[model samples]
Target: MIHQYQLNGYNIVLDVNSGSVHCVDDLAYDIIALYQTTEKQQIINKMLVKYAAVPEINKAEIIEVLDDLAGLKKTEKLFTPDIYQSKAFDFKNRSTMIKALCLHVAHTCNLNCQYCFASQGKYHGERACMSFEVGKQALDFLVANSGEMTNLEVDFFGGEPLMNWNVVKQIVGYGRKIQKEHQKNFRFTLTTNGMLIDDEVIEFANNEMHNVVLSLDGRKKVHDHFRKTFDGSGSYDLVVPKFQKFVKMRGDKNYYVRGTFTHNNTDFTNDILHMADLGFNELSMEPVVCAPDDPYALQEEDLPQLYGQYELLAQEMIKRNKSGKGFTFYHYMIDLEAGPCIYKRISGCGSGTEYLAVTPWGELYPCHQFVGDPKYSMGDVWQGVTNTELQTQFKLCNAYARADCQGCWARLYCSGGCAANAFHATGSIKGTYEYGCKLFLKRIECAIMVKVAEATLDSTATE
Candidate 1:
């Protein structure tokens, strides 16, 4: 389908199926819009009548534009067959092959961040860690269900995964053993708060975990204001040194110093700059996702400032790229040049189909974000997804199912938004969060601008 929108004073046309983007003038935009709903002859006749009074109206040019639009249709760019509808995934016939599992090894955390989504690691339940036996069972379940998939992924997630270091270590060892016997490869990742990172933890993480995500909310004041110890002391001073040490030890590996920005810190460009200034290369700063009523939650009013911050960050990233020291910002790294096709676009992330999250007790969830929420629990390792209906719900949840996403130019890019965020914000898997939609569109626009700037720079250098 053809999606049209105006951004930054430019009229943009997106050919969704063919993945073509065009920047056209107002007349061309109107012509394309009319062409979609009316016949070619009708469009030409209407255009001739509508622009007859204007002396600058070129009938030949209008006809040429019509020819171009018709060519697009012929090539299946403007009006392609509805492959998404024609070949919709039969959820009943979905494979039970699991490719990735996020193991929530710990339901407890060391720091008491005020906006802890997990309710300070207790998840509104009793704080506990996953037993080695439960972890072993989870691995066995993954191996049995993986079916023909050679590479599997296991992410050690929290509370703070480090809090359950022993079990985490045991699970890694067990997974390694399974990998050798089954001729399968396991990719391990760990997400931590960095508060408990000592020499031993660093050594173990460097050797075992393929990637490490360390949480730090930027500057000392902003970080300490929210993330604190049980005694309410700031964790910045405690964690920063440890984080530096860990990063140094885990050299050249996949690691991210991930942070969260709240309503309190909408001017988050400084946070990115601060992290970059601290000699860290890979970084990701995401906005806090929570109920709108929460004081720290990003409200509709914060969007303007947040968008401006993204622009500022984009400019800073451009400057860094020119300065011979470039860092990877997670949001800025959108692969717009080679985005997914229409088939993959409709089915986002394959959450329930190929990926599942395992809780400390061996209960399975669609994702780590839905760990504590029992409503999303598909099954446990022992039962192997008893709730196929829930899995089908997730598998069928896509942009194609949402009316609001039909005409959005950014729909393919976002893939109908996150299901977990949808559940949290609107209590429905198919619901769209307006705040997230806006942020996604703005960021994508900024990414496009970044690419344009780089291209312009290259042209100038060559000249």
Candidate 2:
């Protein structure tokens, strides 16, 4: 399958299956759109009539475009057959080698973010913290189940991981102490609301953590709307300076300031820019996940504005990049030359199988998003995953498994999207969230355009 679009004054055609990207003139672009659907003679006749007034119009040139497309087809770069359907079945039989665990260290938070998916980090259950004993067992469980994989990932996540600071430190120390003995390398990450960042926390994180995620929703007004302290006041003023200091000391380390945008702020480009201006080079802003009836839920009317925002953000990124003041937007990062492997391209994030979330009490869920739901509970860390049936179901969840994703141009880019999102929007994990799908497609388009524009600029400079 092929997808075509005109962006930033360039006509782009993307061969969906083989991942071939082509830049073509208007004549070739229009011809390729009909190349697969219309008869060759009919296409030629239609082009002849359509371009009759043009002095350069000719039957020979139209046929040349067809010839080029045929050659691309012969090379298996265009209209490549769907070969991943059968492979989707193979995942169920593959041995489970758990590679990562998102440890819910703190099931409590200092701030009361109204729009929080985790119900203020309590996961709608209890406000508690994971003990060091539970965390150590979680890490051990990962090592035992990881098979021959030498590298494993552990993310310290919470309502606010720093809220359980001592335990977080002990767990990191334990991971380091045991890594050499097991011949395993544990890469740790921390995600926090930035309410408790101190000099010591920053120093330890820069030394031991692979990456850190700081939660700040861009501008003060946008962030303060939903994220607030227990006293019902905005926490924006309290956290921004701390986050800025943490990031400043972080130097070249990996980090991102993650934010969420709701209907209250559909024009999130301004938020992204506000954060960029604050000296945060790495940033991401995601749409808030809420029920349809929720006041902040993005409606159908918000889509057009959101689309415009993504385009505006992409264009702004290009301009900033040209001036050497560019900041990275997580969603806009795409590597066309080398990306995820074919298996990864088809399947969702290895949740429930290769990756699991450990709750404060050691219960295992598919991932953090599914933490509170008892139905998704796989098992505990000490006992390991006992629910093989649920595990197998997630194993079979792939791009090919979703009928809605089969014909989508952005299917491989998102790998059928988040399973939790699918389950929440629809009744089943195999279903699609049409609302998120639309926004995602727009982002992918903008990402591609930005890459194309950067290449064009670089080529011109060298000339």
Candidate 3:
């Protein structure tokens, strides 16, 4: 299968199955598009007619382009077969070992973000915080079920993980103390709203956390509109300085100023640029996920604007890169040469099987998004996952398993999309969220274009 598009003055062709990307001239691009469906003679004749006005594109060049495409087909670099279909559900047969756990350290928040999917951090439940005992047991459960995996990950997540700062520290300390005994290395992450950030918090996070995710929705107006204090005030003033300080001190460390874009702020590239201009080099802004009826939910009409925004964002990144003020966008970070293996791509995120979320009280769910839902509650930390049926459902949730994704060119790139998003949008883990899929495909397209632009323009611009 092949996908082709013209972006930013380049005609790009991607062999979906083989993961080969080619930058070809206009004549070759047109011919490759017709190579699979039309006969060789017919394709050449069509190309000749289409490019007859151009003196450089003649019958001989058309025939040569066809021959080149045919040679690529023979080498399995173009129009390759989908040989991975048979192994789509191979994850079902493998032993499930836990590798990561998102611990809900605090289910209470100081801010009342109206668009928060977690419902103000309580996750649609009563406000609570994780205890040191439960946190320790969760760590123990992860170690026990992790099999022989040497590296394990634990993310301090929340309404605001800093709200339960003491317990979060204790859990990290306990994990570090026992990692040597178990021959396991624990990599910790902390995601916060910046309400409770202080010098002490920054120092400890810089020392221990592998990465920190700081929430800021770009410009103050956009962020303050949805993310506000319980007293109905904007948090933009309170958080930005703290976040700037956090990132300034976190030199050379991994962190992202993550934000969410909704109908209210479809032109979210401005937010990304605002954050970048604020000295935060690493950034990400995702589309808001909410009910169809919700005012902030991105509608079908919003897609066109969002698509343009992605392209604009990519173009801006290229311009800034050339100017030596380049900032990294999380979604645009694609390593085409050596990405994740096919097995990882097909299986998607190992949510239920290898990764799980622990509630403040130690209840387990496939991920943090599924927390508080009784049906998705797999088990408790001390007991481990007892809901094998749900686990199997998630195990079978892959690109090929979804009927709609079978024909999608971006299927492998997204790994069948997020299981939690699928379940929320369509009421089943195997279901596909068409809306998210459309947005995701656009993002991938722009991401690939950014990569191509950087590689193609870097040397020339420098020279």
Please tell me which predicted candidate would have the highest lDDT against the true structure: 3
Give per-residue CA lDDT, model 3, range 1-463, as digits (tens).
Answer: 9999988787899999999888888888888878888988898778778888999888888888878988899998999999997687875547589999999999999999999999999999999999999999999999999999999999999999999998999999999999999999999999999999999999999999999999999999999999999999999999999999999999999999999999999999999999999999999998898888998899999888999999899888888888899999999999998798888888878888889999989999999989989999999998899999998888888888899998899998999989989999999888999999998888889889888887676444222
Supply the global lDDT for candidate 1. Answer: 0.83
RMSD of each: 3.7, 2.0, 1.7
lDDT of 2 by residue, 230-283 (tens): 999998899999999999999899999999999999999999999999999899
Model 1 lowest lDDT segment of ten: 454-463
Question: Against the true structure, what is each candidate's TM-score?
Answer: 0.87, 0.97, 0.98
Across residues 217-324, which tens digit of lDDT does each residue of candidate 1 receive?
Answer: 999999998999999999999999999989988889989999999999999889988988898889999988777888999988888899889977877787788887
**Candidate 3: RMSD to truth:** 1.7
| Backbone clashes, candidate 1 | 0
**Residue 203 displacement (Å), model 1:** 3.0
Error of 2 at 26 (Å): 0.8
Report the candidate with higher TM-score, 1 versus 3. Answer: 3
Model 2 TM-score on a 0 to 1 scale: 0.97
* Candidate 2: pairs in clash: none
Clashes of each: 0, 0, 0
- Runs with alpha carbons beyond 4 Å of true place in candidate 3: 458-463
